[model samples]
Target: MANKRGNVWIAVSGVVENENGDWLVVKKKYGGLKGKWSFPAGFVNEGETLDEAIVREIHEETGIEAEVQGVIGIRSGVIQSTISDNMIIFKLKANSSKIIVQEDELFEAAFFPPNFLKDDEDASLLLQSFAEEMFEKMLYKIDGLNPGDQFGYTSYRLFL
Candidate 1:
């Protein structure tokens, strides 16, 4: 079966882990995800490579200069009927941990540890699960995915 070609709006995100295995995330201040914590991500701009876009997004959103460790995974969500966003996520090593959140769109940017009760802090369950799933894929390198060939990460369907 051949897949039909349609417009897939592609985006990129990064996973910058601290030495203690915590994940860096941001709280959105606009749109549907307002106040919910998520990773720093944005659309791949025209004339920019995915790598460059992810790095730029991380810096712009979190003020973190991240060295791309490897291509870790993929995340996708559909918006209504026509707009579907596919995000390519990478694993990064922070050159520095300093974060300067873009207050216009995000309220706070910080690292949150894993396996903690997210509901207590009002973090998105889906986003937390997404982080955990990507972490596991990064460790196991399942489907023979490497740093460069990172498309085999995982898929997600977000309701809101």
Candidate 2:
């Protein structure tokens, strides 16, 4: 495990699903990445594995119990602020339906098609850029109809 700058933070996100096949994205209310559109995610607690963090974060943030299907991918990026220096991004595919927001941590919760990030107005520019970049990579992979050389990007693992 790589440590960022000096601070260590591990975060897990769940790509939860509904019966209609739409994915869920939550509007973060506070924190460095606040106001951005993202899947349900949070820090990894003591004695927890990656999957455990995924299940815990999903339940805590979205009020949904998710049975994780598999790993999406892991992303690590630098935090440009003084508060934190790094972020470990875990994307997980989860089986879920009901979503109950924990009020203080999120602003709004909604489900949309996997491509919804393309048209979201409230998503931060950084997030939109990341999402778009990942989406394009995924589209190309799908066009090729192969997962080979396609699992390296952020969107490929998260959007499926």
Candidate 3:
């Protein structure tokens, strides 16, 4: 199947925490965000759910298997009034600490201390703000409800 919607792109990013309370971040090797540190993220593929996309992206970028805890945030905006970019941010729990960064997509990958990005020069402002806000308050999350089939769409997940 082809992508019928060309103007809209959906992406997912995960904020994964290790057992030591360190957060996972990746440095992009290309694009405008080159050299900037942020959470592991990628565009969703056709037929992939947001949760599946985030988990896949996290593993693909950082080689860390993570379980989605819930959705933490969402960012949506229009680019040049032509393209719509929407990103879903998920909170994840890392299964292990060891990271094997993907050489093609990332410059580096590592776990950082809490609030590490707050004052970091190489971090994006949005990421910095997220770091601060995440630690400062309890975030409301949309969690998965049981029996996805109840919605009639087998792949549909109810988050509440």
Candidate 4:
């Protein structure tokens, strides 16, 4: 169900990095990535702007109020033979640290430090591979705006 761009669907995600550089990832309760970790993301609803969709998805999946900073990166490719996958990655500044998991879609959400997928040890090869595939390389950088410059995100983890 793509929009006017001929894409199959639009997947919007928010990339929020903490002061310690750890990334916010969620453990899926179902789907292919069930029990695995990934960024807080979801499909863009009909008649919703990218900005609105990203913020809504983040809050719906993980209880984080984040302000859209700017575009981080985007990846578009083919999936399942003909299905078009258009993924837009946006950097968000979390205004709060409270993490109230959405029980229906996700079971747990946490911040994983960068390089959690290191290949040095004999940890789980599959997990490492998944992490690499999910977030192997970042194609963008940021300047001027720090992690929590505008928002008052004191910590990445906040108990509800």
Candidate 5:
């Protein structure tokens, strides 16, 4: 299937956690989200898989190599009544704690305790909500599935 209208945008984000039980967050350097703390995220490029996009985004924004653990959540909404945006949030495990922030895209990147974002004034509302929810309940995640050699697609990660 193809999107003939081209009005939809697909994005990916990661809730990355380190071994010490801290979460990774970054402050964007531009746009409406400038200076606000949020998880590393970006638009999924052409021909890229969802898991690949989340890992690439985390590395691009925070300079931390991470592996996708599972799919955490999905959010969809229409922006400005024209563009439909769909974002898939993934749970990631950081390979290393060291972060070399991408200066052009992010102002700062660091790991913080779970309770930090929920009360931080600079954190985005969505980030705060996620943090609060994480503190209160366990997030249901969809692990990757290895389909048999039946499907001809290059990659398949269905939330089942």
Candidate 6:
């Protein structure tokens, strides 16, 4: 996965949670993140919006249709020698709890409760940090706070 400095794949993902209050995660089957646990995600196709991509990826990976609740924030990083110049991260909320595994793209799927990351798929510390940041952002967003609002340590950027 040799990365080009300015060229990168456009990817979308779903930060889904179930009734048990656990976040849904999957183990990627192929590519740079193969065998690692991550939120259901995929490359955005030729003609699709970020929201559409997230919905499609969610259904394709988990066999469940999810509703787009909100945008947590965008995260960009380098991997496979690529800079991910056009990457888009989306935080989604789901309505279905009956998740079916799509073996070709993901080996397994499950819900993880907060603070329980024993099966974290990402091995890179950089990605882990990004996940933590996203979670913080999610918390803020779920609590109905403006991420940019100057509310002491309540903001995602400041919390981390």
What is every candidate's alpha-carbon RMSD to the true fold? 8.6, 8.7, 3.4, 10.0, 3.8, 8.4
lDDT of 5 by residue, 86-108 (tens): 99888888998889999999999
Q: Write the per-residue lDDT of candidate 4 for residues 10-91, one digit (tens) a residue.
A: 8887776666756667777886678766677788777776767888998888888887766656768786677787877777
- The lowest-lDDT stretch of 10 consecutive residues in candidate 1 is 151-160
For 94-124, candidate 1 gives per-residue lDDT tens digits of 7878889888879999987755524435566
Best by lDDT: 5
Error of 5 at 44 (Å): 0.7
| Positional deviation of residue 88's Cα in model 4 after best superposition, in angstroms | 0.2
Candidate achieving higher lDDT, 2 or 5: 5
Model 3 C-alpha lDDT per residue in residues 1-160, reported as the tens digit of each score: 2245688989898889999888899999997789998889889988878889999999989889998887778889987878888998888899977899999999999999757687899997667978888643224444455555556654655444
> Which wins on TM-score, candidate 1 or candidate 2?
1
**What is the full ranking by lDDT, best candidate first?**
5, 3, 1, 4, 6, 2
Stretches of model 2 off by over 4 angstroms after superposition: 1-6, 80-94, 124-160
How many residue pairs in model 5 have overlapping backbones? 0
Model 6 vs. true fold: TM = 0.68
Inter-residue clash pairs, candidate 5 = none
Cα lDDT, all candidates: 0.71, 0.62, 0.83, 0.67, 0.83, 0.66
How would you encode candidate 6's per-residue C-alpha lDDT over 25-57 as one tens digit per residue?
Answer: 888778767877777777777666667788898
Winner on lDDT between 2 and 4 is 4
Backbone clash total, candidate 2 = 0
- Assess candidate 6 and give its lDDT: 0.66
Off by over 4 Å in 1: 1-7, 117-121, 131-134, 139-160
Q: Total clashing residue pairs per candidate?
A: 0, 0, 0, 0, 0, 3
